[model samples]
Target: MVLPGVYAPQEDTALLAGALSDESLPPGAAVLDVGTGSGALALAAAARGALVTAVDMSWRAVWGARLNAARSGLRVRVRHGNLFTPVHGETFDLVLANPPYVPAPLGGRRPRGAARAWDAGHDGRMVLDRICREAPALLRPGGVLLLVHSALSDPGLTVGCLREAGLKAAVIRRRRIAFGPVVRGRERWLRQRGLLAPADNEEELVVVRAELPV
Candidate 1:
């Protein structure tokens, strides 16, 4: 069960989960899950025999994830901190992230609670951009990073960022989904920003995978 202020597993979460399942994870692989809400992805990785670390900025998420892991009898390292900060200097075999990518007017103030889980500034790249820039450093040779975000945030930009960082990056999956409350509420603002069309109510979620050279 998701605790208050914790992001529940939704379509994008399921998409990432499915992709994680399809991956050929080496036994006891070192796995990192950034912005791991509710510990779903991290637990899934643990269930596959991977050594998992899940990070989030919310204390609630940290506690919730730890509780969930303990209840499931899975070992997971859950830390509360901004994305990647708590795990600085660590390299992993695979990194997974499903960060906030909803476009909204954030007013230059850091959001709180549920809004903090989804709002990503006017262009929705606030967090996604940072993830793309920093995640590669946390990967070992031949390690892979899987990131899922709204297509409206421009998934290609992410692939480009990873590629620029010397990794092989590409969009591995895309799914069209109806706008969630966060997106729907900002429809007018998004349209004004030219990110959404007058008749558009759906947004595409894209999963970009980047692999470091072995």
Candidate 2:
């Protein structure tokens, strides 16, 4: 779909597919799609008959999502805000997110454009942490939270954080993607900075699901 002023890329499509393929999702659910870059997940959920509210930080993204939703004949409420700010005090039956998971380098300039889209904070869990922390407050009783992120960001840490937040988190899906090139680049930078160990050459994209306590 044409996303107006925003750029469409393969990664966004992959993320959408990963999120929409979750079998745990209930039909006719009220869903919230956080960081809805191009509204892909939101549109897909809407197509499944779910009432979808999509949130994005970029005004461009919001407009693009709306355009795509209209073109796809899917009903989605697109809002512009950071994380859950736009939906404060609102709750949903399901929440899905494909947050930025790449950790930024130590003392270096951030990459531009779509690359900037994927960089999380230093440990790559900045957005993830906030999402997990706020999720319990935004989910209905027995509601589901689905998140797709990189294993490079420390999946165990993510799961632990979610659990600490009182959510029952479990890995429901995982796929290893080749990242030899990424590893090479990161390794070079790390070595130059006197850091030890080679970077992980492969990244595991995982889908984590959590259910609110009944």
Candidate 3:
């Protein structure tokens, strides 16, 4: 069950799960799910016979993921830490991330409570940029990283960052979905930033796949 203050599974979660299914993993492959709110993606990977580890900065999210893994009878090592800190020095065959990508208004205090799940700083790259910089180190040779985020966050820049890190990266999938409560709440700010057109009612989510060279 999803504990209070944990991010619940939604369109982005389902989309990431679908991408995970398309991957061909060996038996007992190692998988890492970053920001594993409610353990949805982690559990999905575990169900596919992967040895999954999930990390979140929120204590509530860590517990929620652990509880969901237990209820699902899935073996997932859930840890509490910001981003990749808990998994330092560990490499995986696959890494999955559905990080906070909403563009929050500038000059506000760091997000708290449920808002922490999506209130990314202005431009939405606060966490995404860190993932690009650090994720490659967590992948073994030929390992894959699958990341999902809104087009508003600039998927092109994500691809560029991964490629600059010596990985082959590209957008593997795209889905147009209506703005969620979070994005809708920031509609005016987003439009002012040219991230959203006034006539647009939907945002596109893109799945980026980056692969490390052998």
**Candidate 3 segments exceeding 4 Å error:** none
Best by lDDT: 3
In model 2, the runs with Cα more than 4 Å from the true position are 2-16, 24-27, 106-116, 180-187, 190-200
The lDDT, on a scale of 0 to 1, for candidate 1 is: 0.90
RMSD of 3: 1.0
Pick out the ten consecutive residues of candidate 2 with the lowest summed lDDT: 190-199
For model 1, how does the per-residue alpha-carbon lDDT over 7-125 read when each residue is reduced to its tens digit? 99999999999889989997799999988989999999999999999999888889999999999999999998999999988899999999988877877887778888888887889
Give the per-residue lDDT of model 3 (tens digit) for 121-200: 88888899999999999999999999999999999999999999999999998999988888878888889989998799
Worst 10 contiguous positions by lDDT, candidate 1: 103-112
Per-model TM against the reference? 0.97, 0.84, 0.97
Model 1 stretches with alpha carbons more than 4 Å out: none
Estimate, for each residue in 1-214, the C-alpha lDDT of model 2 and write its tens digit.
Answer: 5454453544434754675676456667889998888887788789888889999877788888999899888899999988999999999999888877766684455545555457676677778888878988988988878888777677787788888878898887778777544444675653454332355555567888888898
Residue 133 error, candidate 3, Å: 0.3
